[model samples]
Target: MNWNQIEGNWKQFKGSAKAQWGDLTDNELTEAEGNRDKLVGKIQERYGIAQEEAERQVDSFAAGLKH
Candidate 1:
C-alpha cells in the first residue's frame, strides 16, 4: 500500500506494524502516527540500526501490506 493509504488507516495497520517490529513500544507507534520518517526514527533508535536501514525495512513493511 502507498504511504498515504497507510497513514489514513494507521489504526488498522498498527497490529501489523507491531508484529513487524516487536521492539517498538505503543507510545513509539503512537508517536509515529503513520509518519514514515517518525516510524523510521523510532525503529532506528530501538533497533540501533542506521537510518537508511530503518527506512529500507519500513519501506519493505509497507510494500508487504495488502491494499
Candidate 2:
C-alpha cells in the first residue's frame, strides 16, 4: 500500500508491522505520525538495516498481506 493507505489504516497495519518487526515499540509507532517514510526510517535505525533493505522488508511485509 502507499503512504496514504498506510496512514489511513495505521491502526490495523500497526499490529502486522509489530509482528514483522518486533524491535519496534508501541511508542515509536505512535510517534511515527502515520508517515510511512518516517516509520521505515525508524525501523531502519532501530534494526541497523540499510535504507534499501528496510524498504525491501517493508514492501515484502505489505505484499504478504495481499495473500
**What's the TM-score of every candidate structure?**
0.97, 0.84
**Cα error of candidate 1 at position 39, Å:** 0.2
Predictions in order: lDDT: 0.95, 0.81
lDDT of 2: 0.81
lDDT: which candidate is best? 1
In model 1, the runs with Cα more than 4 Å from the true position are none
Q: How many clashing residue pairs, candidate 1?
A: 0
Worst 10 residues of 2 by lDDT: 58-67
> Once model 1 is optimally superposed onto the true structure by TM-score, how far is the C-alpha of residue 64 displaced, in angstroms?
0.2
Cα-based RMSD of candidate 2: 1.9
Q: How displaced is residue 61 in candidate 2, in Å?
A: 1.6
Candidate 1 least-lDDT 10 residues:
26-35
Clashing pairs in 2: none
Model number with the top TM-score? 1
